[model samples]
Target: MEIVSFEQLDSTQNYLIEALEKSQLQAPLAVIASEQTGGIGSRENLWHSSRGDLLFSFALPLSWLPDDLPLGSSSIYFAYIMKETLIEFQSSIWLKWPNDIYYCENKIGGVVTKMIGKNLVCGMGVNLKKNQKGFEALSIGVEPTFVCKMYLNGLDKKPTWKHIFRKYKLEFDYHKNISTHIMGQKISLHNAVLCDDGSLLINKKRIYSLR
Candidate 1:
């Protein structure tokens, strides 16, 4: 994985997209920054990433993806990978349905995936050193580079969809458990299902579908 780090940027997402478009990089390029002035979030919301947060973006070629996997599943897969990595820090991370990452009821991070030409660009934001207002922070005692390294290590392995799904199932259980304990919500994990098209289902109801 190649990482391009910046001290400050208007938006890491924009920088990544522009870089990829300009350089015409083949695929799998990572863009990380210490601070992003105009960060983006899911559903067209503004992502308020403070200076201490971990913000990054990467581009992946669609040709490398598995034929059986749906395009929308990238976010879910990335979220699970991140949750697994955060567990190493003893941080109990939870997936709020599709892509939001919660520490304990409060959103600590999120993943966003966008399509640029024929490539998929994924952007991730995590509260590491500092937390935004109304958001919680997890002191993982690790730098963004280290986290990125760990993420790349796992991603480079190119685990099968079944392997990724197994990991997702485990995190989904953890998510339900944390929701029950922290939010007093009794959501059944059995109700949770991954649809054939990669949408997330709860109680057989479609909750979130990726782009």
Candidate 2:
């Protein structure tokens, strides 16, 4: 994988998208920044990136994945794969519904996926140290470089989307207070039903987190 590093940037996700759009960067490229002044978050929030935060954003052509892949669950698929890789290192890490990484009850990182033209861009952040925020750092220490390598490796596998969706669906029960917005309204996951495509069926409406 090709990587572009920056001492400081506005947002890794935005930069990566722009680079890919302009053909200034290629697929399977990772853009990492030491710090981000305008970090983005899923659910329309701001990601507060501080010192020691492992911010990563990568782009890949849509052809790299399976033909029947479900795009809405791309974030969960990538985040869960990262969690599984940490398990290989004997680290205790779990993923929340959709794309939030959690260590016990506290969140440690998050994943966001967007489709730009025919490419898929993934933006991720994992706090390695104290952030002085609501989220927690990873329970066990992991080298950022190692984590990035593992993530890219997982992406290379190009596992079937259904395979990933099945795994992620099993973990959704843990997030009892599902508070995600849908169609301009905050909807709880308690009454929502998890579907085979990794979407939620609430009030007969199918909702997906395709951010």
Candidate 3:
């Protein structure tokens, strides 16, 4: 994958998406910034971050995705892999159901996805440095660039969906105490059932992480 790094940017996702749309860049490419001024979040929200946050967006061909992977669960798939990457550094960060990144009870960062033509673009914002208030930072020390490179290196191996799902299920229990938003309403995950395709069955209503 080709990676382009910047000292600062408004939003990596926006820049990458526009590049792809204008034929300036292609899939399997990544854009990173040392500081993101205007990051995006799920539901058209803004992902505010400080100087040392891990801000990046990468695009991959849809055909390169695992055959058994469900489109709606792309956010979880991407987020879990990143959570696994952080664990390699001895960090205690865990992925909340769907896409949020958490440390114990506080959130440290999040992942969001978007479809651009035949490619899938995933944007991740992680707090590796303690520069933001209210939100907690990562538990371990790591150079943001190193973590980004290592993550893409691991992704190049292309683990199967079944493999990631098996591991993610083991940690699904951590979400029972939390709640998630669905159609503008917050719903508890305590009774949410993790389906084979990664959707949750809450009160008989199926919910997906289609960020």
Whole-model lDDT per candidate: 0.74, 0.79, 0.87
Over 4 Å off in model 1, which ranges?
131-134, 173-192, 201-208
Residue-level lDDT of model 3, residues 33-98, one tens digit each, is 998888998677888788777899999999999999998999989898898888887556788888
How well does candidate 2 score on lDDT at residue 47? 88
Top-lDDT structure, candidate number? 3
**Per-residue lDDT of candidate 2, residues 1-211 (tens digit):** 8778888899999999998889888887899888899888867689886867788899888888777677887887788887887677546577766788877666778899999998899999887767666556763566676777787887788888778777776678766565765667776888778888777888898878676
The order by descending lDDT is 3, 2, 1
Q: How many clashes (backbone N, Cα, C below 3 Å) per candidate?
A: 0, 0, 0
Candidate 1, residues 74-177, lDDT tens digits: the string is 88777777877787885567776567888877788888888988888888988886554656778766887788778878777777666777767666666553
Highest TM-score: give the candidate number: 3
TM-score of each: 0.83, 0.88, 0.95
Q: Where is model 1 poorest over a 10-residue stretch in terms of lDDT? A: 177-186
